[model samples]
Target: MRGRVDEKLPMDGEACVQAMMNETTMTKLRAGKKKFKRSYRLQKDRETIVYSPTRHSALPECTKRLPAEQAYDVSNILEVFLSTLTSRSSRVDREKAVGPSNCFSISYKDQTPTLDLICTNPETAQTWVRGIQHLIQSRTGETIVNKKERWISEFFHAADKNQNERLDLKEATGLLKRMNVPISSSHIKERFQEVDQNGNGDLDLEEFGQLYRQLTFRQEVEDLFNRVSSPGGTMTMQDLHRFLTQEQKVQADAETCKRIINTYEQIGDVKANDCLSLQGFTLYLESKDGDIYNHAHDQEYQDMTQPLSHYFIASSHNTYLLEDQLRGPSSKEGYIRALQKGSRFLELDCWDGEGGEPVIYHGHTLTSKVLFKEVIEAINDYAFKASPYPVFLSLENHCSVEQQRTMSAHMRRILGSQICTDSDTPDPSVLPSPHSLRGKIIIKNKKLPPDVLEDEVSDEDEAAEIEDPEVQARMQAEKEKRRKELEKKKKKIKLAKELSDLVNVSQAKHFHSFQHSQEKDMACNMSSITENKAMDLVKRQAADFINHTKRQLVKIYPAGGRVDSSNMDPHVFWAAGCQIVAMNYQTPCDQMDLNLGKFRQNGGCGYVLKPEVLRKDYLKIDTSGKIPDKYRKNLTVRVISSFQLPSPSEKSTSSADPYVKVQICGIPADCAEQRTEWKKNSGFHAVWNVAMTFPLALPELAMLRFEVKDHDSMTASDMLGQFALPVDSIQQGYRHVHLLDKRGGDISPASLFVYISLQAP
Candidate 1:
């Protein structure tokens, strides 16, 4: 039986039980003619689904209740994927399964039988859906965020000019224009042909999704064929070898290249010649068993129980801004984008808004603000989608008393089970691992000391009166401002009490000295240091940092002087075992590129475990210009070939003759930079057989960046594409080096063939 849950009913256990007993109507739940309908009520915590048989009124139901944590999903009967056990139902059976049936199925993670129940009416069906959804939300601490399905609907609606669900070429062009994506009409026609899989002239929403996923794939395959093929559209053996070794960085010898061509022909066309075709190229990329970023080989599963500091966490500074930090508009999309890219730590600068609620934005700047509640909701919804790891919310608070209270209340209520209000460990001697806090939000903020009582200002007033007339007036004004600020601060401190309760796991504090930090038993005392200060420490007390950060968490941020949102080179700080080396995420410069690439290992789950040396208590860092081992020797990278590099712009027909630059960033003394001569008039077949050697002392912390640039005589060279990877993770021998755009997305078909080898000096 189903009815509106009365608002007057008390939320307490006895009241809920009595109400359910009096209201619930027993009905048959038939599955292939077997009835298993049962009456159920939620436990006090609303996490247990307790059920009982209506016939057994004298005896109790099973003591073990169906825990809500076991449930994977809950929805209406029509929404779930149902498999009929018997043959097709008769018309009578079909009639029983309609809206009046109110039959729903709930699958549990445990091997328990799927719960099938029948409700008396539509209200019961609705109540079941809502109740199960609420139970799942509370149990998993998940809230609905920017769902991809909803996003697709919104995107399709915007693109469907005539209000129809289908998009024509003109509508598609308009959609591209709105996204600021430049595409030629010919390219659009070709894409439409490929995307309209059913041979339809226009694309529906699903077909459009297929088009979005393969936009780069189709573009690159055609561009690559154009670059390597002859006028007759066939690539010779030499052409294939050059393209593989020089452009795509496939690490194939001439014979290996021949075999690859043969393999492609075999898979695409058995009756083909010793040549490559567009069909073969497309097949290689689209195949499920293809070598394009294979998760099996690329991802390294490591132990996640190490101390929290023993990892390089993907983090962002001023995460709300997407462009220039000072003038850019802030939106919840920033959080969504960051989390989607597997950034685990996000900084939010909260200030009291016009309303009583708190808002997030760059303080004392022209940047726009996003609602604090919205940001938290977005974070809760998306934090674990990319990586099921804990997310650290670094709060830079500047809210007033009432607003701070509102923020705490909103966070506790909206975040609900996601907010970690207390430590999981009985005695947290060391920082908890990311695995333990999965799907949880840890607040990192300052624990302000007790508010000091205001002292009598009679002595200061008397002293100010004795000064010269102008000086006395200035002193009195300054005193009044200080008094007002102090009073406001006192109020803020008092209001911060509830918020501070949520910060049980991590506390923000000023860093004094390495020894001072070690003496404290605090598992996580996060200290944010300016880039300059961190650099100074690295120069003067590198060992101290290396020692302290092994057990404690340290966040190194950009200096205040960097108003343009320029990022600090994170590798230098990373070498010293810093957990969160934050940078201005708005800037997509070399620093951000390197950051994205280094964390690309470990499945891009946003946390890369530090090397064993960094986690040790006592270890030599080897800073004295002496090679420690073969792994710490000079790395020689040979730039062989690059393929399908993006032109200056999509509209421009002229192909760019590109060259490569290799930058090795790590410990300051180990840093090296080099560049290759431009390949003249090569278009997509740019080949620079240039080799450079980078002396590496600490290879574990090193990041190798390769940038492709178009040579120009009248103006500066434009960046075509770039790829970055940690030197330690690079596979030796011949390898295919996939290229990436500035935003760290894969530039498919655009790759480099490189030879990598290490030599000891």
Candidate 2:
């Protein structure tokens, strides 16, 4: 049964408030069969949840204290759901260990373990779950003023020691240090005294908030406001309309400007007058309307009626490995994480196991194994969680006929009707569109001829697995000898009919030549090529490769020499119209960032419609830094300033000297980068009003990447944050580019202000 845990809970304001205020006793279930009774309560700030051992528990006195270490931030929570919504194996085990209806789990970010709690009853469980979910939803929908107030309140509470609800000079200094506010102690004291209205040495939460605003005031924002506002210090609706159309590049009229004023203008009289004050203008610039990414493309805005081959699919290679290919641990979590990140194509290296079952892992390597049945179950549960597009299982079968049959049975049993088999009988001349195959799972594996029996043998060459450094070095020393031995040892493996019949839409076949593929004209067949081989084909027969991809599917994966699981630049393959460029999802680099940015559009459904040039046969693509003048776009970007950038150094307590790097990644003709001068000791507010221009050959296929790094003379610079998006989706005019950490999590309130202008050649 599909889990309903992800569904939104009904709002129970009274019950939620009560649950947050009172302590609820529950049983904490941990891994390795450990359980303890604990009392959980949400902190008064509503930003943290703390728990302590119950009075009846046998835990030590030191652990029973309600310390800060025992709390978790509410912002870190990804989901709160009943335990019964987990995978089948986990559900059964949790049900048996703790009564089913009373158990719940909190899934957090950054690969943290889920917190499993068993309440005294179902009502109590529902209360906690609804309360947590309510808080998360409220935070997500909070207004600018509410968010800022909460942020200031959280810091004030953190600095207010001794539970006195007030902060003295020492406490205020500590808070400023924690906030990384680059200011002198004397200046801080002066501001503190000014905000201390009653002349008391200590300040309350309201007083502390005033002090924070004084220290973190944005002079850059004030200057921009003055440039746009009237002499009376207020912007009328006409003024806003002009600013939107001319400065932000947005097409806005009086009605639209009025709506924006109503949404972001905080003052009652200013909003009633259909005008925006300085504070209201600031909120408007920081809101989603002013974001760099075009919000219009935030949903399923693309034409989904195109054939599957006419779209780029987000795919993963070695989807089960959590680390390096040689000795990484293989778990179902890898599959879970990939699916959650909108990966529609998952690779499974299946081999025979100890018993009659099959397992998935890197073959002939030290990587740990996970049961194939469990992996299938996990896939069934998470296939459509992030997206409703059809998922593809790219199977690399090395199992014997018996184990292969077992694998097929497990897939059929766990996935049920979601698995598409040969009996579906898709048209052989053309593939189906993503819209037609929604909520389905398609298998991509080798299939036998109709007349062939299960015992019939077929020769299939497996890609060489990544080995240990020493083993790889030895093999390299005797490369020709090793090749000869491998060729001699290649044997014909029997194909099981049960497994073979599952392949229908995506039948794997050996790729011969581009001309040969065109002659065959079979749309259902696909081929997997290594990055090196694919690049070679691109260099030799660029037009032929493009024509071939327009008809059929091609997947390019990392070469086996990359034991570190590094990824190649996917833009090259994408420019050639290759639909699936598989990446090692476990690795993080610029290539992965590009991958994420490319698919981030179209509702992040893992299917991005290929550019018109790539989908049509008549249009020719040139990757040699030459393009027709008609398709060129003159793009100008001005890096205006940044706000609240995080310090890159963990060892140094001082601020950072941040610099911005702007890059255009696309066809060879459009690939270029420019860097701005670093702002010294100004992580909080760095201004660099520098402009750069690029002539992009193909704007539809180009991506704009903005990276902020801390400059250091003694060592390589460290990355603070980055944000990337397609050039086609960039909103023109002044916009805030919200930054993300290396793992792609949002670093809120940390963003760059940029001005963009795109003109046709």
Please, what are the lDDT tens digits per residue for candidate 1 over residues 1-761? 12233334334434333343233543434434455335665433233344655544433334554334221212111121111122353111211132333444453322223445556654454455455544344323221111223334455665665656798877876665443334567887798898787786888877876665454334435666687767776676677777655654446676775666655553344315667666555444333123223333256487788778888899988788877655677876577667867788998888889868799887545678889988987786667878988889988777765787788898888788888755464445778888888788888876543452221111101011112333334456476664555344322334367676677567876677877887863766777776787888888887778777888889888765565778988988887778898866657788989888878788888999987777877665633234456556778888767756766654354567688888998777678889888876554566676788887877777888889888887788878788887876666544556777776654544667566776576
Superposed model 1: Cα runs more than 4 Å off: 1-300, 448-495, 622-627, 650-653, 758-761
lDDT of 1: 0.64
Which ranges in model 2 have alpha carbons more than 4 Å from their true place? 2-14, 17-31, 34-40, 50-71, 84-100, 198-201, 422-425, 455-463, 471-491
Clashes of each: 7, 0
Error in Å for residue 368 of model 1 = 1.5
TM-score of each: 0.61, 0.91
